[model samples]
Target: MFLVTGATGNVGAEPVRGPDAPVPDGARPVLGGLDDPGTLAGARDAGVRHVVLVSGGSAALADMSDPISRSLTLSERAVRDSGMAWTLLRPRAFMSNAPRWAPRLRAGDTVRVPFPDAPAACVDPRDVAAVAARSLVGRDPRGRVHELTGPHPRDQLAVLAEMLGRDLRCVGLTDGQARAEMERTLPAEYVDAIVRPDVQEVTGRPPRTFRQWAPAHAGAFR
Candidate 1:
């Protein structure tokens, strides 16, 4: 039995779940920032040998200054020290995150961004899952940190320009404005996590690109 962190994270299911959604079949999930003794004990009870932890962004920020990073770091430490085999996956910028732009895209060709110029490489969640699967069943992926992302780092505007395939308007926001709009719901560490560069060398294959991802998910914007 496997203790998948999220239905959509390392487990690789594709669906946007609100906080209230059921776990759906075949999923045993452990959310971050909570005590995991029960969950880990359950995994142990289930005879789970390998654990795949989907840590967001590239850095664990283990220093734990903030609640979000601290929680993730704590969870990773618990799993690593659990005497069970574990693989830590850190991926930057999921293309699925682009749905945050959906309302703006639906309203007009204009999109607003906090860091339109900051470098970010959109990662495909499916690829992240593949790596996790390899870690679980293929070989010993223990004691390894997989930093995953697309082939090239791109700014928000560039990604949208490529995905939209036509002229698009982009509006830049002040940090204050951006924080109010986006960070309101997101955790502080998540909103502030440093964007790590793409490390395609780990998988021995190129990371998936926005162009490749947009078509399948384009319906969200429309």
Candidate 2:
């Protein structure tokens, strides 16, 4: 049976069919996180044969010196060595990240955020999940890496401005400032984010763009 770790997460939640996916029979819970290779043994004993891992774009950077990259790299290795069929998904930042500007936007028309000048080909987590579901349900792409992305690179701040129908102003933070703000929630690992056709090649459709995603989730920003 297929077992998706982080099933409640952004990408994983999508494949489980919106709010949640039904856990397969005999699915045993693992105590330690992905960083703990010992946890993987539970899946094999639970009758799981395939593992679809949702890594990050940083893994594509291949810099072991970076802790995020190192941890993801180690997790991938554990999955590979686990002897179970595995597929690795490395997706760029998610369109859902746009909603993070909500609190600032709601407070006022001006928003100060990190990396205002940076653009990302931010993907819809649903698309990432679509690819994962295919890999889990099918036999192809086994032991392969799918670098997922949206249709194009975009200025996320500008997109939010248009979506919220406000003359939103962005105060771009310096590298040091950006690092300080970002490090609060996640470790900093910068990479050259790019768009990929893997989503279309696998799902036979174009990946959703931020334009498409923004409107559907505009309520969050509003």
Candidate 3:
């Protein structure tokens, strides 16, 4: 049986299946969180031999000082020591995050956000899930860490503008303002994510670009 952590997250929410059928039977859903290691005890006792963990790139960039990085690092460590085969997927950013701009886009063409000029090679969550599925059901990527990213880095606002068929503008937030806004939800950590071939290496195809992702999720922005 396969045990997937963060199953409701952007990456883990994507279903993983084999050629014959879906693994673990879709009817059963396990409630768990990384904050507590005891939650995994149920799955481990149930004879689950493989675990797929969705860590972040920040874990590789920062040390234990940063809470976000510290959490991801600890999660990765927990999976590694669990004695079950594990795959750690560290995706830079998710294209799905584009939806966060929906309200502003709906209100007007101008969107204000932190790090407007910051280059991010964000990956589609589906691509991350594909690699995870391959590792879970197909191959044993045990004790391996895959840093995933999209095919290219481009202006996400531009892509949204093109997809929504409207003139969109971006107003960059001041560093202090950005930090305050970001800290409301997460500890702000700036990472200039670069493109990686790990997605292609694992899934045998290039990761989807923002342009490709934009069209599919255009409904959210509209």
lDDT leader: 3
lDDT minimum window of 10 residues, candidate 2: 184-193
Model 2 residue 38 distance off true place after TM-score fit, in angstroms: 3.0
Tens digits of per-residue lDDT, candidate 2, 106-211, equal: 8988777666677667789889988988887765668889988887656777777776677888887796777676554342333335568889988888998787
Kindly give the number of clashing pairs for every candidate. 0, 0, 0
Give candidate 3's error at residue 43 in angstroms: 3.0
Better of 2 and 3 by TM-score: 3
Candidate 3 stretches greater than 4 Å from native: 16-26, 173-190
Poorly placed runs, candidate 2 (over 4 Å): 19-32, 61-65, 113-118, 173-191
Cα lDDT of model 3 overall?
A: 0.76
lDDT per residue (tens digit) for residues 1-222 in model 3: 555666657666676442234555554676776545675566677787888888887677547877888899888888777767778888877888889999998899998877787767888988988988888887745889898888766789988887777999999888677667755544222344557788888888888888888887888988
- Model 1 residue 194 lDDT? 48
Model 3 weakest lDDT span, ten residues long: 184-193
Q: At residue 102, give the lDDT of candidate 2.
A: 82
Off by over 4 Å in 1: 8-11, 14-35, 63-65, 153-166, 174-202
Tell me each candidate's TM-score. Answer: 0.72, 0.79, 0.81
